[model samples]
Target: MIWTLFLALFFLETESSLTQSAAIVPQDPTLTIGSSIRVTCSVKPELNLKAENLYWTLNGRRVPSKFYTVLNSTALNLTLNNLNGSKQQSGDNLLCHSTDGRILAGTCLYVGLPPGKPVDIICWSRNTKDLTCKWTPGSEGETFLRTKYTLKYKLRWYGRDKECQEDHTADPYSCYIPKDLALFTPYEIWVEVSNRLGTASSDIITLDILDVVTTDPPSDVHLSRVGELEDQLIVRWSSPPALKDFLFQAKYQIRYRVEDSTEWKVVDDVGNQTSCRLAGLKPGTVYFVQVRCNPVGIYGSKKAGIWSDWSNPTAASTPRSVSERIAGVCDPKSGEQNSTFRRELKQFFGWVKKHAYGCSGLSIKLYDQWRVWLQKSHKTRNQVLQGDKS
Candidate 1:
């Protein structure tokens, strides 16, 4: 009976010892470039065990303690900094053995390079005004190693290896291009990724900057006359290009001189649009007219193109009757009223006759006469209205 009891006790002790032995299980069975990894060894429960003599081997070569950490008599964590964990590292065995010289546990880590070749890179503008670049991210399977990526951009304007910018991000995909660069320039960009194992660069991508050109001008421009006394001509024009996004507010100027005068007068200080009238012309005298347009760009900067060639000058004369007074109502007030009424009647008759056949083929002399009289009548009425109000 005693022998039987002793034998049973001995067997139980041996079984317990075997069960308490340590075993190494790598957290990640597969390793990749640039990834940080941990390997652990679990030891069976044993009283008074100390973390001493834990050993790790990477690919048949002993990994120095500087590269790995041994914890609590069991766990071994290896951080292969900057070292790409690849096929060679994967085939190597990581061992955790006891100080007692018993092999507790072992596991082979398989490291691999990330699959897939670098893909094409593409670039675009952010606001149709600035450029941007982007690319696809690298991918690994479920057991993939963690990775960091960088994007490098170079401008062709700067020459080879000269203008390079680096961008670092956790994701492998996408980057923004710099904004507000000069229009009509070219740029080149590339991307790269690095893991513990190694680094790979993507193909270079090139892009060009282009201005959003305005193919058409604002549209048909027309002129109309306005104003009261002083024989002022009020020229008014309509807005061009109805499309809200495309439409640009513009500044206007009138270039005019007395008939037979060679020098041009510019009235450009006025900002944006298509109209201005000439004032203080002699009654019955003809004046020539021309118009120029100035468009405002971003930042309110003026962009002036060639001035439109002189429009066929529409001639206008101040009303002569307004200038010459008659007897009917001789009081200064009565004289002014009678003169204004006659001048207006004459101007109206002239305009009717001139435009009766429409604007086409109207003689320069007739048109000029009609315009002068029209301006004179309009100015006189405004002066009278102003005096009455005052």
Candidate 2:
């Protein structure tokens, strides 16, 4: 029994010794950028090692001998100056090695900036069901360390402060609260960031869920030509389906662009109308249109609701110019040349007067070309008539 007890004690001592490090001073230190530090490695007396035979490595790379200071026969010192931020959030690997390249002692060097005050904490709800918030990092925004960001919120009057679970892998500065949000009650929200160096909290914001609610994009956007009008197309869309049951008045915006172009022209005067006439479009050209909605006084809240995302693009084309249609109608192959020309000129003037409310420069240019052609056609007709009489 005594021998067994001795064996157990021997194993325990060995395990304890293995758990202890080789006595590196300033173990696992945290530091700011541009700060210097002095680290020391001490050898156990039983190891029979000399400090002079010791060397150091930082992040697996050998440190130059100029930074080494041999304090005694069993200790060695390394001084680093003007340290930069750590290469990783876990910290920089610093190891002391023997001359023959055996690891004697090791520690991590955490060199980075502290967390700054989180700024621009903005929160919005989806149909007043849940809340989501995002914030901008203070200053340069890169902490270079493993910083923790916590989003805390509560009812403005009285409630337990709760943390919003942050999905750092998805978005480091954003958090989503899925359900159980109050509608009319105001919420106090803020973000707090922390690291080993320091901590800072953002300015708290108070808002009701109804005040910041946003709905899905407007749906079923349809576009069509405005009845023989060359420069106009009619766009129609249904209000956001999610908010149809809610008590709110929606203001819509329409933006369109020519199919071949990337620049968009926005129409903001489309009050609450689901159908709007887009004018001043290029004739006989395809256009893409999109619409968005802003709910005003949602649930009788005084503040305007957030704007929904732009709807999917819908495409339509305007009709060709009146002159083009007239030319098509008065085909020379179907009728006598003199009679066809006369019919085209008569239709052109009447159609332009009826259709061209806001005539574009292209329409005026077409009219000028048609006038010159008409004068030449009349001269030719007179010549033909004279020849027949002769």
TM-score of each: 0.29, 0.77
lDDT of each: 0.53, 0.83
Q: Tens-digit lDDT track for model 2 on 213-323?
A: 888878899999755667778999988888877634778899999998999999999988889988768778899999998887889878867888899999999877555
Which candidate has the highest lDDT of all?
2
Q: For candidate 2, give the lDDT of residue 254.
A: 93
lDDT of 1 by residue, 1-390 (tens): 999999888866554443357655553366555656666666655544455456656655667778766565545555665445444423556666555645666776656565333466655442234444556654543224444556666557774542224342543466544554555455666777765446677777765443221222334434333322334555554433432243255555567676778877777775665556555554444566655443335223233322323344555544333444322323357887799768766866666665665655555445446655665665788789889999
Best by TM-score: 2
* RMSD of candidate 2 to true structure, Å: 10.1
Give the number of colliding residue pairs in candidate 2.
Answer: 0
Q: Model 2, residue 49: what's the lDDT? A: 85
